[model samples]
Target: MAALSIGIAGAGLLGRLLAWRLAREGHRISVFDPALGSEPTFDGQQAAGYTAAGMLSPLAERDNSSAEVAALGWRSIALWRDVVAALQARPHFAAIGSLLLAHRGDASAAQRVLARLAAEASGTPRAQALSAAQLGALEPALQGAAHAWLLPGEGQIDCVATMQALHDEARGVRWHWQRTVAQVRPGELVFDGAPSQRFDLVFDVRGAGGRPALPVRGVRGELVWLQAPGHGLTRPVRLLHPRHRVYLVPRPGDVLLLGASEIESEDRSPVSLKSAVELMSAAHSVLPALAEARILRLDVNLRPALPDNEPRTEVAPGLVRINGLFRHGWLLAPALLEDALQACALTQPAEPLVAA
Candidate 1:
């Protein structure tokens, strides 16, 4: 196949991943985003990928999402291994599995989740009902919790590190930072007060940024990072409640990512006080030691969702629009990448433009 000039809108997870993949296939890639940094930094938190906990739980997600999404997640897990190995970056990729815990009051809700997973023949590992002793042995930090289910093969990734490594390693790709794309047509990209640019193919993956042009709605999600001194959770843990479901993902250096608030608005404001209190309180219920943890950061971002909440791909002669990942951006990214590549008819394996 001949190399083609590919124009990608949005430098978020999907955009960066596509650039890294297509650039390696020897395509001349140009990525445009409104975010203000050429390189990923501490202050660079504009994309929704930065605010995510990056949990890759396919079985757990079956409770609310379609089986297709879960299947994509399972596939993405294997693809992530390849991506991390190729990048050689420490994104803290972990496949030790995740836990689903519920208080006595929410046992019914947790049971429903377990039943749903049990009925599906997804080929992934079946969830195991853990006894208190077993749960304690698996995660000693949650010894106080009585009900727990272990979803094997579920995992997480460090989104910030993944994005940074993608940007750093994708050689021969031009990045347009702090530039907002106005429209993406087949093989062409339009910008405000600028001339239109044409490419052999164009990919729209702006996440929530691809609004109006695409049938995408913004669903708000907020996450909080905590610096806990002695919290020893080796894997992601989901605490089930009637009102909201919160998850605690442990990162390197004793840092914990706690979040679960999903509102139906497109607000990009700072984390609200009500959400902070609810998240902190729910987190404390599961792991009491978190009460002493120091607050590190609060992040609020909008996830692009379609009406159906499942991800969709619209393919044309020289364009592909991929969006509506909802809260499963990291979980479904690699599979979506594969689908997009097929839509572009790039069947050959990608070869690196520059040797690593």
Candidate 2:
């Protein structure tokens, strides 16, 4: 492949990951993030600093997603494992699989969902179904949960850590932080204050770009960090319910990240009381012990959702737009990034997976 100069207009997960791959392939890459100003500062932290409930399984997501979801999800799992292996020493990552459970009344529903998941997960070993007894043994803290399903081989990483690693890994790419991108025209990349930078190809990834045709909505998720009393809760737990699903991510020491509630609100304000009440109640229902846990902090962030619940990559004459990852950003990232790179001609084809 000939060395190419690539310009990216967002430093979020998609932007950073694409830039990293392009740079590795000997592409001259210049990146600009509106979140960062002229004098870029490397916080050595992940972009957005938002909390994520990292659950990755197309089969598990079939209950709320389409067949295409699992197919794309399976394609990304191996890539994620490779990335995680390289960043193993980084903080805020746990490979402990995800748990999908249910209350007594909804046990059958959970089973049905699990069966669908298993059927779709034929080649994907990261997903499994666990009986009620097995579920209790895995998560002793989960009190009175009638039935449970386990995605035993699935895993989660600290969203913050993964983002930080990407930023740090962009050693060869030109990373411009605090730089606000205003527009993208033919052959020119526009930014605020600085002169427009020209590139052979430019990418528009401003998550919430002002494009009406792009069908993307914000699914707000909130989480609270709490310090638990015991040390045995080692794995991540997903308490599945009819109205809501909750996850408990155990950080180092006794601190456990408890979350979250998915609401269809795009407002980027502080978490509402209604959301808090709902989240706390769901957490308590999952594990009654959380009733006595001390609250550390509360966080709320919006995930870019799409009609298809999958990330879309579109290439124009000299520009490409990538977004609509929904809550499966991490789960579906590898495939999405690969698609972006290929559409932008950043990576070579491997026996031609599909048309570009």
Best-performing candidate as measured by lDDT:
1
Q: After superposition, how far is residue 245 of candidate 2 from its true place, in Å?
A: 2.9
lDDT by residue (tens digit), candidate 1, 1-356: 89999999999899999998888778899999988875554332477887789999999888889889988999899888788878867577988999999888887877888889887664678999998989988898885566998989999999888999999988899999988899999999999998989999999998887878778998888888999988988999998876666999999998999996999998777888989999989889889889799999888888889999999898999889999999999999998889778767974446432346
Residue runs of model 1 more than 4 Å from their true location after superposition: 39-45, 349-356
Clashing pairs in 1: none
CA-lDDT, candidates in order: 0.87, 0.68
User: In lDDT terms, how accurate is model 2?
Assistant: 0.68
Candidate 1 lDDT (Cα, 0 to 1): 0.87
Model 2 scores a TM of 0.84
Q: What is the clash tally of candidate 2?
A: 5
**Highest TM-score: which candidate?**
1
